[model samples]
Target: MAKQGYHHGNLRQALVEAALGLIEAQGPQGFTLSEAAKSAGVTPAAVYRHFAGRDDLIAECALQGFRIFGDLMNHAWNDGRPSALLAFEATGRAYLAFARRFPGHYMAMFESGLSPSVTPDLAAAAARAQGVLTRAAAALCDHLPEGRRPPASMISAHVWAMSHGVVELFARGAPGARGPYPPEDLLEAGIGIYLRGLGLIPADTAPDPSAGTAPDTAPADPAA
Candidate 1:
């Protein structure tokens, strides 16, 4: 359907941008279609023409946030560093950076509880985002011992839980958050620990000098 003013162009984009601000300032509960339309200088009815309702808009917003987040992870892993574990670490750093930079979007993507009601477009966007992470997990799986590859769903869930635990806790005011550590070292230790438990890391080889002891993943600095 058509929207007011030829110049404003897409009302959907405008509504998404406006909703982001609302999410940032007032959080998901405070995000509303009427408020978004007001912020975008469009009628709420105009927003409805693009979205079925507030839930629909929130679902799209969540999916967009995931797309942005997935891109960050893809970029981090794009370097193709020899160590799949290293690439995983880079992805983690990128993920944390996104959460810190775009807390509103971060919250919307994970905490808003919007995915369940997403339309096909939003659902596809979300799946694409997850596919990026799933690919990375698959890479890490290669280094594991035979018969050790985690089930696809389990691996994706665990890695996401690990990454999100750090970001969400810090975002929600964890008292122990710390600044970003050397990505390789932190991830090496984490991957090492997890892998070692599953017998993935080669035990006979002396630890690489570059390998770092896990610097407390526990959030230490509130300002991270």
Candidate 2:
């Protein structure tokens, strides 16, 4: 039977938000199309009005996630402001912050098993989010020796992987989610180590990327 009393200003977006909540609670494959419809306070058949199937709905959610992610990355990079080092580090902090604030969107974008290339627009959005980091990496590499600078793509990928690992292993849900170190510290120090190896920052000093700001007060993690 169809749900009867629900109304919304934007039914499609209503469904997407409802589905995102379900995904956060139950993982992507854990919920059914009927569940999403019910969560949206509509009939199962109503889902087909905005989506071909469950996969299509999840794809839309991922698409929206990528757009938001791209925006966050762009803002964090801030066109390489303060300094390239700080801006680049801000982007890294932004990665953990996004995962912390938007678990459903994060999972939808990464762990949903839906290939971003399922749609051209989705692919573009995913690429745009990643491109911001790549651009930052390229700028930072300008500090290194021209003869031995690794590809910016490789540098960005390494950082992305590290950030994602920290989020998965430490940053999300409850105190001490993983190891002893906070995700921010772990990632900052890790990036520092990586860059020091590349001869970017001074090798002897501590790896303090956002030296102007206190450790907890750095401007990368946006409010949830």
Q: Against the true structure, candidate 1 has what lDDT?
A: 0.67
List, residue by residue over 62-108, the lDDT tens digit for candidate 2: 99999999999999999988788889889998998888888899999
Off-target runs (Cα >4 Å) in candidate 2 are 1-9, 206-224
Q: What is the C-alpha local distance difference test score of each model?
A: 0.67, 0.85
Candidate with top TM-score is 2
> Candidate 2, overall lDDT?
0.85
Residue-level error in angstroms, candidate 2, position 195: 0.9
Q: Which stretches of candidate 1 lie over 4 Å from their true place?
A: 1-6, 171-192, 202-224
* Pairs of residues at least 3 apart in sequence or in different chains that clash in candidate 2: none
What's model 2's TM-score? 0.87
